[model samples]
Target: MKILKRPAGLILLLLAALSFQSQDGVAGSNLLFYGLAALALIIFFYIVVSVADNFMVIESKQIGVKDTGSMGLFPSFREIFRPKKPEYLEKAHVYTLTKGYDIPMAGEPREEIREPKVTRFALTPPDFFGLMPIPKMLVEEGDTVKAGDPIFFDKKLNRIKFATPVSGEVIAINRGLKRSIAEVVILADNEQQSRDYTLPAATASREELVEFLLESGAWPAIRQRPYNVVADPDVVPRDIFISTFDTSPLGPDLKLTVRGRMDVFQAGIDVVRRLTNGLVYLGLDGRGEDPSPFEAINGAEKRYFRGAHPAGNVGVQIHHIHPCGAGENTVWTLGVEEVLLIGELFKNGRYDTTRLVALTGSSFSDPCYVKTYAGANIAELLSGAGEDIAENARVISGDVLSGTQKSTDGFVGFFDNQITAIPEGNEAEMFGWLLPLKPRASISPTIPVLSDDIEITTNTHGEKRAFVVNNDYEQVMPMDIYLTQLMKSILVNDLESMEGLGIYELVPEDVALAEFACVSKQPLQQILRQGHDTMIEQG
Candidate 1:
């Protein structure tokens, strides 16, 4: 029977009718050889329960300490995992937090703010346009620049460049509306100089550490995953990752932004392990019980990843460890505060750009941590730090689910660390979606919300209907793709089913929790940034 036209030849024709009905004695009076040995033991226990439900490994009994120094009520992770010692297992893996994410973790950052007073910084130019396109400028408007100079470069990957965070003068380039380059302003002088170039990160060479991180603009702090962009100095990636924890909501704590800078965070993990020869990994935040000065920093491979709000999204730990298919290879990542600002520019040869940020929300009256620099001046770091802003609040700049809405006199986004602010729902709630119990803040547990400290508002509260697939983007996307078949292959622009539904694992803040659990409020991070600008304008 032509070997039953193959399915491994019909599983060897049902194991030769169960081995000739067990040696022709009519094994239990053969009912077609007992239905071919119960359909080969139900396809071998359905391929061992679908490979143990896709390689399940969630153990965790203890380990989840996220109170990076202060800020009142912000516990959960079931108050740091529980069940203590028995020779420690502590595995991790949870991911849920998509319930109307109003998680402003009560304004953290209790201590460290060191010496933040900048004056005016700005920069922006679409935060270094990720990887190329929109670059050009090179100083225009009274020009003076100093703290690392080169105010723009990539006219098409012109060795990248883009510098300037402090050494003042070039007053305002601004631009916008199709002219593009918005915000280049500088102005900060009080003795800031800084142009040096040194190097010798323990004997450079990886082409002199990628030409000293593309001539000191710290090579756009290394992004590259199929299209997170900026890290293609001839692509030799395959694994770098980094993360170092930020669990989203009001994220940003890399151990209180690298406090006391563990020897510049282990000299930025030995200068990003000399730009990859593979394996750097480093995730962290598997809750906590000491051990993490970024797990005593030495040459990464740490991992951990506890739970909630994109478990510190390093592209969901590179989709649970190395899963970026579609023309593969590129991996890279970086952000443990931009690897301590590229190990403080190869251990202080200059270009520091400071950092710390945080600010936070629920319309801050005093949300903390500011030290500033990368485009500092969100109304001068919330002037006197105890904000009141309101006029329908909303500041943003980064985090309140993938930030950006700026304008409290904007500027603080070159890869923002956190600013937020909140409140701008635009009123009008009479019946508020046929109330079933609503105070707002919903990932729809059939609408019951009264308060998870309700304050978030850019209110969609339902409208842009249509695309309903359900299970709310796989209950807050713990990534393995298939978030509504990759948003229906990015709403049918289907570049080969959006790279076979992975879209190089994804970004737009990993689909901002599937666009905050979309019930078709589909903007879905502007359709994954228009499928990463249509795969970078069709290659």
Candidate 2:
């Protein structure tokens, strides 16, 4: 009885034994070996059921269930191994996540900085969430404005002003369908001039600081979870988080971005510390070389994580550090460069919108970093690579897994730190899907990947199909969110299930890896957005 403690698992093992004993009326030592292998092969969910019976524990919910703790709705890995105490929750905790996938592609940017060929920059309104498609315009075309000049304001949230990144002329107010302002294009001046703003002291009131950030055009850098949208000026966040690295496929190197400008980055952190009453946490790259200067920064606590692609995602960090309050509480996050923007405003007394962007992917001849303003022209950024690229290359603002697609005429996104260009896979490959021997980065076992770096193309081997119910999505996703269930709930507009399944903890980029690993070819990001839009609309 002690040997077979798990009654349910014993029952299943017995059934497996019986099944193997019959062996379709054919018996051999191989059948006994098969039964033994089967028992060891499958002990995940049922491992506890029989064990719990021996211990007189109920696996299912019943009246007056033992209050050992909050019992899981069902058996889980935690049931096999007792859950650890909250010892590391207070202090800095280091996590080595075993789950998660890394997509390696060619064209990592060189460390050296290069002058960009961008003469025109733009501010796309659609890049921001929680705003009307078209903001009330404050400047007309041909109006000369300085770097901090307000170009537009959302009528609903009238206090926040959107500023131009560079001092220039308003060349065009580009519009999309329904005349929604798409891009507020600016013709950069040869000699840039900036308008200085009144900086708040480090000890300023939260309201005063929030107002200052809003008016200074830096509030957009702060985003709230429970829905990855603009941080509401009215709500005070529980805490703030910043990931000081990038681990996406050929992501821009943040160490290069912050090496020489630690002071500016620190200054940004100092000022932002006043916005939240709780601690400001910095998520650092554990895989990078030791003794990084980011660890020495003041005014924030440091947490180290070393893993694949999403180890650098703030959402993942937030989950481990302090599981997002979902809809119950607000958690804010920002990029390192955005912090630099905040720091530059307060420490330098100017709206310095300049940031180092990594231009990557195999389409370019020479990939390197370019110092440019937010929303620089994509064509101009790519023109200085000392060669021309094919017209059909797909340009993406951000990383390959979860980036916005763009044309050469398109501009970089407001929140993007890298621009990726990959060959479009439009033509069919000869039995490529059937054999799949082409050189490319993949996580599937059938693909037979030998190395991480490879030339990635857009040829999706198959089209979207029925939802293949399995752990395919979970294999790549590090977070504990039930991606398959959540995505299915989103598709069906199951608001209650979506909320229960942790929809508040995700944005498109957070789910991009699962999207890539999806066997169903389901657009997870779009579906997540659909769920978010529904929730937002309902609210």
Candidate 3:
């Protein structure tokens, strides 16, 4: 029994068990003898595995891995049979998400960043969630304002300021349903004007840094979790998360967005680090062996994730890294572009929200990156591309799967970096559901997917139906939460069960793929958002 821990001893024990043929040359109780032999082999195999784990630790240390615990060659047998984590979730910071659905859409942007003269831009209050129906306007119609000048402030949270993206005259303050401020349109100046803020010190107090961000109209860049709203100024977040890449269909290569802007990115990270009491985590693209630009970014912790769409979602990254829980366990997330904007704000003391917007989808004549401000006019952007955008084409402010729909006159979303234009599915294809012959995007075997880049239109094909229980949600959604159950809870307004089912770990984009994969054609994102509102209202 004492010799069971050693490989040599296990081998001898195995030999003894296998060689002990009951002395009667294997009698009628051969089943027990066979069991004894199997047990010995299993023990020996576990011992060999223990030795391998020990060797791996030693080898890791030899290569200067200081934190690899226990370098003992003949390690304990328990190491082999220890209940390990499931393959989907590894113990390390690096993750290889196995379950997710990649949407193939055409046309993808070429490896070119186009600098178009986007003259018109707007700041729509509705673009941001959790803001009041109407924010108190700082500048009105025909008011001349600089880039960093305050446009409006939330009535409840007066400290957080929303700034204009460019130096321009406020041409219109469009009102929507119920006199709510729809958009504050600006006729941008050719030679842009900007406000020069005082850059705070690297070792500045949290109050000083927060004050600078608030005053510079960059506070909206730091959004809180659970509600996915603009974080309050008084509360320091538990942690901050940033995804260095995007995996949504026709998503911009974020690396390109921040190209030659590493210094600014690092400075932005420094400011972000001071915003949170805990660590600032960066979720990097781990599919490639090459190091990301943010790998060298200082003052923040780095984590790697490799998988399909939504893997690059900061919410997913947050869920895996340090999931948001109940109470004041608040967290915040920012995009790579937002980080660069923050960096620029602090580095140069200017509020520059320059966007490298990816114009993708089959509707455009040239699908490529366009450099513009945050809320550049869609019509100007499309016309600048020298492509006559079809009046019927459905333009989106972001990716096709989860982006906000927009018209030619619509402005780009504040949080969006990519603009997608796809063909509208106004006229349904005859027998399209019965025989899905078109080379389109679908995880289901029904639609013949020939490549990862298929032309997808805005058609659902099928209407919403009874929620059928199947493996659909699990196949596409890699999170540990049961989406089917969670969606049901949301549908019924069961807040208690929603929290228990990991609702805090989700945002609308996190379940966009799951919604796409649902056979019922459920409006999952809408449902989830409603649930979030319910939770907030109850609280």
Model 1, global lDDT: 0.71
lDDT of 3 at 537: 92
Question: Which is the winner by lDDT between candidate 1 and candidate 2?
Answer: 2
Clashing pairs in 3: 107-361, 107-362
lDDT of 1 by residue, 275-368 (tens): 8788888877655555556767787777675556777788877776667654446788888777887888777777877788877767777677
Separate clash counts for every candidate: 6, 3, 2
Best-to-worst ranking by TM-score: 3, 2, 1
Span of 10 residues, lowest total lDDT, candidate 3: 83-92
* lDDT tens readout by residue for model 3, 1-539: 45555666666665556556554454636755665777778777776766687789879756755334435555455545544443433443566576797787778889887777887899989878999989999987889999989999999989988999999899999999999999999999999878977777767899998888888898898788887888878887888888999999888898888888999999889788887779999998876656666778888888888777778888888776678865678888898888989889878878899988888888888888888889999988878867566557898898888899988889999989888888898876778887776776778875667777677888888899989999998998878899999999999988899999988888899999999988899999999999899998998
On a 0 to 1 TM-score scale, where does candidate 3 land against the true structure? 0.84
Of candidate 2, the 10-residue stretch with the lowest lDDT total is 60-69
Residue range 180-274, candidate 2, lDDT tens digits? 99999999998889887877775678788888889888888788897777888887788999999888889887888877788999889888888
In angstroms, give how far residue 424 of model 1 lies from its true place: 2.9
For model 1, what is the error of residue 166's alpha carbon versus the real structure, in angstroms, after optimal superposition?
1.7
TM-score of each: 0.32, 0.84, 0.84
Root-mean-square deviation (CA) per prediction:
21.8, 7.3, 6.9
